[model samples]
Target: MNQLGHLKQFRSSVPRKRSMGRRKIEMKTIDKEPARLVTFAKRRVGLFNKANELSTLCGAEVVILLFSESGKVYSFGHPNVNSILDKFLVQNFLPEENVPKIMEESVQGTKNSQVVKHEIMTELLSKVGVEKKRGKALDQQREEETLLGGEWWQGPIEDLDLPKLNHLMLSIHGFIELAMAKANMLTLGTKNGCK
Candidate 1:
């Protein structure tokens, strides 16, 4: 055979090695502290970049507060974290009349508002804890489904019967309504001193 034919035969005989690159990681808690730390660092940067892009692209304000396993705080904001937080608090908690005065007061003496800030921070942290619990529960449910070799919501939509579809729709609608009611109540409570 000619050299070209021999080269083709040799290439066919040699098994091509798979690409040596990062493998997909399963969604789970990383057991190793060092590996977890590294992953957190990398993913945190990625998350911040995505947040920044979203803010820029959508002309939306964004604020991210992250706490590492070691309790180190990392934050990112579009304009300024304090400004965004102030806007959120003003819009959600403080009355329209109190906004300017409160801002002025906070600016005049940081110590004067420390207690109020602390209380607000505590409330926000509690909310975060509640959200974390909810997320953990969802994660646990997904894990259980995976272990059982089935995901409830992953199959073809056309496969669902009408009753099943209607039940799912009703369940989702109820959930949305309940969540909205809870949110409205929380907002009212915050407006009324959260007592």
Candidate 2:
């Protein structure tokens, strides 16, 4: 095994009390560059090994961040710690004032859509009213002609048949009645509980 591997293997083999002096020396001040570097390397390896053991035993993710004496940074993570931390921060770390702004934007979009739908419905209702008025006027004109020409509705209005005109009037009346019923349903739904 390498020096770090040996250190990790021997670390637990030595009792805690027995290794405390050297562990402190390893972590704290050291006289020589070689000695401190060696300690840092070995301890870092041992720490990573211990982290792996903890992760395996407890079914947990592990991450480690270390800064060397020479000012370089080292990092280790089991499953993209930075991404998970970023997601956590995004969900849980927003300022209170920012929340109201997001809510206001959502409300504005909903209101705009509702207003557009209302305008469309209003236009359709107006068209229905216009059509209904036109149908009533045409029915009235046909009824007047039937009264004036007593036998004019017999075959067809174009051929001046009074009975045919009467039947045509009845069909037109039935169609108008169905149209008005449908328009009333639409209007009622608009006035009552509907979206």
Candidate 3:
């Protein structure tokens, strides 16, 4: 028997530990301070490594800003942090001092601007969308009216179905309402209602 064959036989004698594969971490706040700090340190290093890889491999500008619970700051930047921040500030407004404030009012005022701007933009967009839908409905109504050839009252009504006759009756009521509203306005305007 060879020494190599004996070594192979010895390897087959050893047991392997069974595992259920990698587990997905539940995304929740870590209540334990010590574990959280350790996790932060590990994750921060990994994040920085990824950022460095992104810069080196893709030749892209990368900047990361992180604030720890202890008010410590951690940052990763390609080339420099200041240059990227300056470029960002040129595009968007930022405070004179970028430090976090303890004052609720001061911090809230800054935060509120972004929230308000987003809310206003969303509101205006919804209004414009509603206006567009209303315009489209009006256009469809106009097209349907055009298809019926100008005026329904002037068109042939003898061939119309019961439902169409009911619709025409409603339209006639609408016209009566309009005329009455105009008459009422005129009545309010002058001594004599109509002359």
Local accuracy by lDDT, each model: 0.78, 0.64, 0.68
lDDT minimum window of 10 residues, candidate 2: 83-92
lDDT of 1 by residue, 91-160 (tens): 6666588688668756766765656666777987898799678668667866886899876566887888
Q: Against the true structure, what is each candidate's TM-score?
A: 0.51, 0.34, 0.42
**After superposition, which runs of candidate 1 have C-alpha atoms over 4 Å from their true positions?**
1-19, 96-98, 105-115, 124-195
Which residue pairs collide in model 1, if any? none
The C-alpha RMSD in Å for every predicted model, in order, reads 15.9, 29.5, 21.4
Q: Write candidate 2's Cα lDDT for 74-129 as tens digits.
A: 76666544543333333444346544544454346665543543454587689779
lDDT of the structure predicted as candidate 1: 0.78
Ranking by TM-score: 1, 3, 2
Ranking of predictions according to lDDT:
1, 3, 2
Candidate 1 vs 3: which has more lDDT: 1
Best by lDDT: 1
CA-RMSD of model 2: 29.5
Superposed by TM-score, candidate 3 places the C-alpha of residue 34 at a distance from the truth, in angstroms, of 3.4
- In model 3, pairs of residues that clash are none
Residue-level lDDT tens digits of model 3 in 1-195: 799999999889999778989899899999999999999999999999998987787666678989999999898888876555544443333344532321232335565544544554587689779967866875687689879777555668897779668767766776796797687656533532223
Q: CA lDDT of 4 in candidate 3? A: 98
* Model 2 TM-score, 2 decimals: 0.34
